[model samples]
Target: MDKAMQKVNERLTPEGKMDVLSKWEVHTLLTASKERFSYEFRACSLAVLNTGSTEDNAKAVLEQYPDFKIEVIQQERGIKLQVSNAPAQAFVDGEMITGIKEHLFSVLRDIVFVGNEIETNPRFDLEKTEDITNAIFHILRNAKALQTEVLPNIAVCWGGHSINRIEYEYTKEVGYQLGLRYLNVCTGCGPGAMKGPMKGANIAHAKQRITDGRYIGITEPGIIAAESPNPIVNELIILPDIEKRLEAFVRMGHGVIVFPGGPGTAEEILYLLGILLHPKNKEVPFPMILTGPKSSEDYFKQIHHFIESTLGFEAQQKYKIIIDDPALVAREMRSMIEDVSDYRRSTSDAYYYNWILHIDKEFQLPFIPSHENMSQLELHKDQETHLLAANLRRAFSGIVAGNVKEEGILSIEENGKFQISGDEEIMTPLDKLLSAFVEQKRMKLPGSEYIPCYEIVKPRNLS
Candidate 1:
């Protein structure tokens, strides 16, 4: 209860799960926080405990807790986390809060499993397309995210963390409707639109006397520090990267509802459209809807225009745009989920996981948004529509990295902004859309001065 105790030092045990681990798993996890090995485990663990954080800068969070450290202490029955300099908010009355502790263990559980089983195990040749997906399935299965005997009712919500009050309220209303219909909520598990829906669904589930409601949050190591899980999330699963995280959303949810957002949301929109646009997935009855408050109609128009201009009209046919009607959104999704269920049943696919959808290897591969890679992206229109979407998704992803991610922020600071260039047909609309996000102050939280992280090089000819 003193200023010195603000940074907690505690030996914490697992709450419900992850209480036991093998000697090999513990040894492999011991290198987690080492600098040469990467701060992925350390950073993700911090984010799990730093649940109520409002800052979206990963570098700032790391620097804010430079003295923080955690180690795995092996025991006969189980293992314990020797945590020092952890955020005090995660603890009350000198004991770590139950949810945060559980989240922390979930982080540990994933790190150990992924390091020892998936990554080190040669069975998953990540370069192969199907292997990547199978690896994702194994990761989710290991985390117990894919349930048995569950119907098609999970709705994956996508939006920005830096949205306005109106948009946030709209997400909550939509979530409430979904919960009233016995549907669960899945999200990127950050703030703004992601948090709103789960918060709304929690209240509705209580009203309906639903005790086993699931508020699932799927994230990855790269973005978790910047966008920590909201308190409403009862189930949290951390994949290896953003690409896997995106796939997890589509694979787990029966339907997707998109709320208004910035570049990160734009990235997600493009990723989904790219997959659904694939000829192989044309027969798949995946339900996708884009909706927001009436005030956000122009925003939707802007996004729609960008999509049409880039991926062509074919991409526009993939989803519906419903404005200002949460009930209607829920009803449409609930009805469409019946189609999803039927399709899955007919195809003999599992109701909890979408095995029929085809995601190209391009979407599965991790895109490192370095300066050279960002500049070399083939953002022209001569390629396949889905391929074009994949590039655009990467472009926005790079911009997102430079905006808030630690590595991207450091790259920007060291080498200046990333340079994104392509044909005028793609660059012009792309520039317009990005500029609008900057103008609306969607790139960063309110009261923070937004800066453009990448320069759009508009081509004069088809070069």
Candidate 2:
């Protein structure tokens, strides 16, 4: 821990959205670290207080401030949070930053609600796919994420948290253009590409006098500590897992714009492609764009080549690649999403959520990236292309876990790197694509050398 990273003590009452809590809710929030839900709520709370941290490693961040503690105190009128040894950056002079405070309470809000209402309630049957989708809808509805009056304007941006200065600037430019068109921005809500768009959109919203510009950040507990909620996020929702988070993005946003990123970005692309490839969703008018700066053309090219090699040209046809033109990216998205609006209107689907999109249960189920499970992934081309994309999505997802997630990193430490073996056809392209990510420094931030967490293996021919 740097000695300069000061700690502060404060007791705060929730303001704005999360001002009140029941005694039972307050008790659950207070005892988060000691119960069935594990230490996630506590860890996420700490992450909220440590916003603006440049460090990407979750384990390192937690170890650095081992003494930090947060407690929820119940009151007759409401509840209060007592935080000790919180990172001083969340404060100015002696008061906590208003956004950080709101985020902290939001963490508490989601954790408690998920634990009580979704997990334990008998009304929700998690085993059923429809029930899972219902749970997500309820969670978003509870958080006020769904707005009935608003037209389709939410654009979900996917990209790497570790990006170069040029790419980061390009993201902001694209974001600025989107905001000028009165489009709201939603992202993973971390640093690098995730934060860049929100930051840029804020300025444009200010210029256009758009007061209620929504900057929604959706994340899951497993990766939240690594990618803490950036300060610009006015609406932050923590889904139960990565699969649910991906589903939430697809179901909520009208369109998607993918920026240059590492395996995590690949995971998102594969996930979306898998959903789109399903025969049920083939006609769904979901606008997809892959855009970045001129320097990033090769990055998109490698991604495109990999997709062509594995999923074929039809999968490649699902999205368009536009490099070095932020204004064009925004204009194209604006024009394309109108088609989305028209489709929904014609089908009588809700504007706020995409109920018409059919996602297979395979994509909805959470995949634990344990070594055995990772090694068992069917990376061969024998399966349906959509199913293959799901497996490929899981492969990239496991890599992302090993790269920045604490448990995955520790697992790699305990038992070497994850062994990913597949047909030569897949391994060759997969290895080449991952090599490009490392070469471009997309695996980790600029200063750190990224040690790979998975090894690509090509199986030998059997005579």
Candidate 3:
């Protein structure tokens, strides 16, 4: 369909979601379309429409469709979205695709809720650590993500969106194995590894005669534009920011299975490790596994090297490296999740959320990936190990933003690449791991040239 033919102007009601959306909740969208909230809502909406976009540049997509607009109109029945200048791909035969429509409402539901209920309400103090977690609980609860009836089955999968066929297929097989064991899948809700596992598990769920398979995709505003919600994401949730998004994954997931990915994936690993390394959470049976095809073995090795060298052996112990065995990976994850179930049951913790685990305020607070913030990150070994992991997670997060997020990319253009300086011991391996990602085309889609968005500077005394 031509660009003009693709321009959709329609009034759409909710499908499989938010059919009874409150006027006070979603109306925040129409009112929020003024400043920061407007940008986030519009950007996320466009990202949902650009579902299959190959170009992972958020700014480029916004520029491509400058006229896109959405409005929330309330009625006695519920809220209906009047969207115009929407991408044609989101619709089929003049009707919006059911999945895309569902995702669109999810964005509307979340963006407005955070802007209106969570952020604006005096009850939620986002600055305080406990309050932040409480806000996340409310957000997830609002999304109907917290189900008390089910046991621990949600496996949060993390991997790159630009993965090769081998790695992608491996994710699918692993997911299929998980599905045969009646496990559900959750991810960043994008493509590549995220889509692979869900696709694999979907077929397995079918074969096993299971109909209620949950494919939960959790994302935030910053990353959504570049990594749009893939079609397989039956349940799409938009957290207000990346920090909450990461916390949501850990809070809700019973286990984590990581596939080969780039900086963003590494950022996720660091975030999870930072939390697991805390003294208060040592006994928590939150299983984590890293697996990939044999060819992608080196990728996992590089990740292991980065973690061990920077955060020490303790961080390395937090996860297992399982190579090329989908069945074993699934078996291991399923078995471990049972232990998590027992731990939760015994502790009187909610089955839907991990309430006992402690996340430091350092990790709970949002980090702006600005040039100054990126340069000033404390990447040395002087601080606590978990603190160091938190800083390292910030570094990788900045690179991810530079690589895809619209504001980060534009900032890179206006100011320049981010400069990262730390001790030589950490700098060498850090630079090497990033270089390997570049060479492997894990930083971006294959064949798209990558310009280093950040420079790793060694301590002046050593280099």
Pairs that collide in candidate 1 are none
Candidate 3 lDDT over 1-463, as tens digits, reads 6653368778898866777655665456557655547778888998998999887888988998999998777778777888998988888888999999899888877886555778678989999999999999998998898998789999999999999999999999999999999999999999999999999999999999999899999999989987899999999999988999999999999999999999999999999999999999999888999999999988998999888899999999999999999999999999999999999999999889999999999999999999999999887888999999999999999999999999999999999999998888778889999999999999998768999899987564444
Residue pairs with backbone overlap in model 3: none
Clashes of 3: 0
Cα RMSD to the true fold for all candidates: 1.7, 1.5, 1.7
* Model 1 lDDT, full chain set: 0.89
Candidate 1: RMSD over Cα atoms?
Answer: 1.7
The C-alpha TM-scores of every prediction are 0.97, 0.97, 0.97
Q: Give the Å shift of residue 171 in candidate 3.
A: 0.5
Q: After superposition, how far is residue 298 of candidate 2 from its true place, in Å?
A: 0.6
lDDT per residue as tens, model 2, 324-433 = 99999999999999999999999999999999999898999999999999999998898899999999999999998998888998999999999998887888899999
What shift in Å separates residue 219 of candidate 1 from its native position after superposition? Answer: 0.7
CA shift at 118, candidate 1, in angstroms?
1.1
How much does candidate 2 score in TM-score? 0.97
- Estimate the lDDT of model 3: 0.90
